[model samples]
Target: MKLAAAAGGTLLVSPNFAFAGEVDNLSIAWTTDTASWDPNQRLSPDPQTILKMVFDQPIDMTSDLKLTPGLLTEWTLADDAMSMHVTLRDDVTFSDGSKLTTEDFRYTFFERVNQGEELDIAVGFGTVSDIEILSPTEAVMQFSKPSPIVAQWLSFSASYVVSKAYAEKVGPEKMKTSPMGTGPYVLTEYQRDSRIVLTRRDDYWGDLPSAKQITIEIIPDPTARLAALESGTVDIATELSIRDVKRLEQGGTLNAVTNPIARIIYVTIRADGVFADRNVRLAAHHAVDKDLLSKAFFGGDAVTINQPTIPGMPSFLPDFHFDYDVAKAQELLAASGFGPDNPVTLDFATTNGQFPGDYDIARAVVTMWEKVGIKANLTVITESQWYELNASGKLPPASLFVWENGTGDPELFAGNMFDADLPFATYRTDEVTAMIKPLLKEPDYDTRIKGYEEFNQYLIEEGAMIPLLQAIQTIGYRNGIEIKPWANGLIRPEAITIS
Candidate 1:
């Protein structure tokens, strides 16, 4: 299917009628629900799948992970890269019938930053000095320094435009439960962690969603989601295990789909206590058998990566790899005065069912480490607990985590992962901080890409983190419905069709 423009400059999808009747409603069994209706509060991947249905970002990312116009029709950077000019679409209106303007765009970016809201997206706007409203639908962003990733940042998390007057009138606390946006869907009913219902806005300015209503049930267990799909109670089941997906596909009743997203699963090693020794870090890195982890947990579907970034990313090094050598791991452990008789013990934390095979992979890696005289005390925690620990600088020496890079930019992939100043990173060595700080603000494209390649090499040599497998989004749906997979692993109701 292709997107076409209607007479009024609205987006329209070409109709497809292959089935018997029109599909009016859709039910999905999702793994997790949004933590808050406010899009700018958290940067996690799970919330974006639901938040995008109600809000529209300044720029939209396509299924193939390419940037396209959404709320903003045009955006250009100045020659010095110190200012950005943007033009918004004039035909868009919020669900509450408020016209969208540059004032809302300015408040979404500038006013929130000034309020000191402790937002996750605030880091992306650190260099911006002021936003000059040029017209009702246009604005100019002035920067204190050259910001190369301004356009790319518009497509990242928490970049959605909010109504200036509506937000100010309702305030922050009340706005969470009653969000108004210019998207295709309107929030009709929300029951905390139980269920969420959205109705299609008939007068939306863009392509109308095929399903008139969408019902999402939060099912945390993989088996429960699978049961819902098998019993014909739900149309789509998301975040299924690889084994379950293979079994359902073989049954000939459900269609299984998988998409490799821009997320990388790795173990973050803190640079203190037992991990302060370079030899100990290197020993832990060499102990992981990525090939085995891929075959056992992912069924050979996930890619084994040596760095945090994937193959399609700009800074991915094809030849950089650390072979899984038990002998080498033991030798390194001996050099650090750690052996079977005097093993090094450390706490290793992981989350269960957060992603496909996350807990199993963490357990397998811990077993491998034990063979090399590293005794890891494994503990499973919830995602909220992990974030709480990370915020207070109390994350364990090692923890399994996934880094989401929706923009697919090297600055966000390696730049944020290795930069010690950022909250995502736990390795706080001065050497790493010095190497990554300059690359975050580099104006030139070629120089920034090259710098990350060198920085990736340094990280591998220093054994910064244990790179595991590239994440794969797996889902199962009934045979009648068609769901296109997005590179960011988001299930867009507007992109779905039924025959």
Candidate 2:
């Protein structure tokens, strides 16, 4: 904590007292993204960075986190992979010294689903009623209905098993301050809205690190984050602007890398807004050249995409592609009664100062729309207020939002967003709800994939949500740390090793 005044009592205090362990030759600089540092509260990429320190278990993308062999290894899948029975890995224990058990998995899922903290993945397991504990180390997970994706959902870190004993002992609010997970790092200190410190657990079940202690300081300014990364104060930074891509170009020990980010940024139309008209929507789609905006704004790191899910992932239907069509766009608007006399006026709420040159992109979009007779009003908000407004679901006028679920499963991606019950866009669709019901129940992989492709196509063709650019996830680090590259930006923390 640092003082505000020249001599003292008026100190503008911070949470982390100091970095844990010794500062090593290789240090990582990253920003604390959210207002808080609770793992359960983490819904964005920022939280994931910190979560790596707090949890040591490696994820096996090849198997479901549930009923898999890890902290809790080996499980029984029924005749179909739909339901599973698993046994915990023996001898695993929490930092608090509670033995790992089936109850941990059971309670964690039940808690998150009820709390709605990490429902992005938990929605797949919504059918499971209870976990039957046959013994301390063993249990059976019976689903209300068979779900092939249950394991995939469980594989997410959010569904990670927590020590129920510690959680109850710590209590909810207290647990936020003192989380005990079976990871490489132990939560040592957390200052609300400021910073957090984690120390490598020497007694941790899995392999830890040569670095020893990891401190995550919550720096909101991406520029500030970049500065820290360059100045040797930080070892890694999250969400750097396209300009920073050039900043690192001058060359240093620092390196910048990009991944096909799970995040797909798109424009959302308010179901109740003026864009509710189909022609108004499709015309608006064609009016903006996504390719130009992505190139100018993202520095060639993004692809203009139409599918609700990421490209190359399961159930991704490349059948539909959206491109600029000026003539057809005008015709669609004319057919739908939207004309220059009664121009389609759009109010778009996007960010300008947040990312590098975001305002320019917003302006470019408005300019494109104007040629087709759409009067676009773009309002810029700071990143904080933007998210606050987004969380409220009343996306001001129109809004630009990004979704970053890296599971590579289309059902979870498209189904989670467009699915009426949990439309993150805040738009509701009866057809979407109908489409997902059968899709979720199909047991055959081929059938499921086919159904997913069809639903994604429908979402695109119907303009359920405006499609925009897909971001390649970028992670900049010093040369010492190693990262495994997957099409998805998510790196299994367990697989990471510092050289």
Indicate which candidate wins on lDDT: 1
lDDT of 1 by residue, 1-499 (tens): 1111123254322122122334678999998888778777778888897888888888777776677777877788776678888888888899989899999988988888777877777878877788999999889988988888888888888778889998889988877788788877888998988799988898887767788888999999998999999999899999999999888779888999877899999999888989999899999999999989988987888899988788877888888777888899899999989977789999999999998888898999999999899999999988888878977988999999998888888888878887766677778889998998888778777788999999988887788888888899998999988877788888887667688
List pairs with backbone clashes in candidate 1: 19-499
Tell me how candidate 2 scores on lDDT.
0.63
- Candidate 1: how large is its RMSD? 3.3
lDDT of 1 at 393: 86
Question: Candidate 2 residues 117-153, lDDT tens each?
Answer: 5344355556776778888777777777866666556
TM per candidate: 0.95, 0.85
The per-residue C-alpha lDDT of model 1 at residue 268 equals: 91
What is the alpha-carbon lDDT of model 1 when measured against the actual structure?
Answer: 0.84
